[model samples]
Each structure stands twice: as C-alpha cells, then as structure tokens.
Target: MKKDIEIPKVEDISVAVVKEWNDEKTEEVFNVYLINLQNKQIQNTLVTSKGYGENQSTGEKINTSVLRHFIGDLDAKDFAKIEPIIEEVFGLNNEYWVSFFQNNQMYDKKFIFLPETICDENMINVPLLNKKGVVI
Candidate 1:
C-alpha cells in the first residue's frame, strides 16, 4: 500500500519602498524592504531590484537601476531592507521589478508608480504578494 503525503510551500513574503525627506522636505531618498509575514522563518534569500521608464507613445522602456543582495535569514513577522539609495524621478509610465528567493523558492513583485503616488503621498507601501499589494 502507498500513502499520500503533503508538501508545504513558502509564502507570506513581501517588499516595500521606504522614503525619507530632508529637513525642509525638499529632497527625498528611498529604501527597499523585504517583509516576511509568516510565523516561520525563511532562509537563504536573495533580493533583486530594477527600475524601468516606459514611453507612452513610443512604447520604449528604459533601465534605471539593477540591484541585487543576499539576505541570509528572515525571521517571522520581520523584514529586511535591501539597499538604501534609490534616486529616481518616477513618472506616469514608470515601474519597478523586485524579485527574491526563500528556501530555494523564488518569488517576485512589481510596482507601477504614477505621478500622483509620489507627489501626493509621503510613504509608498509596496506589498510583496502581487502587483496591487506592492503598488499602493
């Protein structure tokens, strides 16, 4: 006789872009953070980030930054901030791609930034699950 077994998959991982303003709030910088929402820990993680600027009329894409980092272990309900220097003028047709791995499994999320998101809001909450979760 054969017995059936179940396997578990890694989930509950997310990313965020944090912004900081200067004394007069004239200049700002950004940081990317990897959030683990699960109760357990994930090991051997790698996070990669890239930015793109798209042309609405011509349909052309431009590369902004190609960043990669290795996060050894991530605790439960914790987060890891990857790189701390993001300088980009996000227009209406700009987007970001952030990919990562957890225990040999790969997960990724993308964020499309509009002019209103940056100009109106102070902190941009980028969710790690899907497009919507990361773009808010």
Candidate 2:
C-alpha cells in the first residue's frame, strides 16, 4: 500500500521588468521584496530594465527592459500568513508563477501550502527524491 506523503510548503519569489522603452530616453526600474510572514520582515531587491528598441522621437537610441529574479524559501504556514500582503503588493495580472522540484528538475505546479512554514535549512542539501520516495 502506498502511504500518504506530506508535502511541505515553499514559495519562490521573483521580480521581472514589466515595461521598457527607449533606454536613453527613459529607464524602468523594479523593486522586489521578500516578506517574512512570521516576523513581517521585508528584504528589498532592485532590478533595472534592459531591451532593444528604437527611440523614434530621439532619432537614435535603444530601448530595453532588464528583468531581475529573486528566489525566497518560505514554508506553508508562513506563506498563508502573508499571502494577502503579497497579493496586494504585486496585484493581479502580474507575471508570477510557482514551481515544484522532482528528480532534480523543477515542475510548474502551484504549491498548496505557504513556503514559510517549511524548514529550508534542513532540506537544502537533500535531494528532491531518495531511495524510498520524494522528500518534502
């Protein structure tokens, strides 16, 4: 009989450049933050835009948007705690996605639990799977 395996919660956070036009004329910037649900601590990350486009008004200039990526580990409980805050900050229609790891590969799947509740330090070095089965 297959036993029910419990999956720990985890969240991966990232910030992408949403807009970029005419590098010389205007530059877009993105600020990414990671909030600790338990303590409400926040970490700020900044990303500059980069892209290639023509600035017709300026005659000659390149337009670009630079995307920045940030990944944070949070357990299920903690994630739930701050889900509302995250949603409010990022809002709807943003480019945000979650992934799961299996056999050394990341799979696109929404985790059911908050990432802050999981114990990251203990599982950092451990492989996603082992001889028995998947490790949460």
Highest TM-score against the true fold, candidate:
1
In candidate 2, what are the lDDT values of residues 1-136, reduced to their tens digit? Answer: 2467545444333221222223474753322222222333222222222233344467564532334443334432232111112222222222223443433444342212122222223222222111111112
Q: Per-residue lDDT of 9-89 in model 1, one digit per residue for the tens?
A: 435665555665645879876655677888877777676655556666797777766666888788888777676643444
Model 2: weakest 10-residue lDDT segment is 126-135
Q: Which 10 consecutive positions of candidate 1 have the poorest summed lDDT?
A: 127-136
Task: Give candidates' CA RMSD values in order.
Answer: 6.9, 17.5
- Which has the greatest lDDT? 1
Q: Each model's C-alpha lDDT?
A: 0.58, 0.29
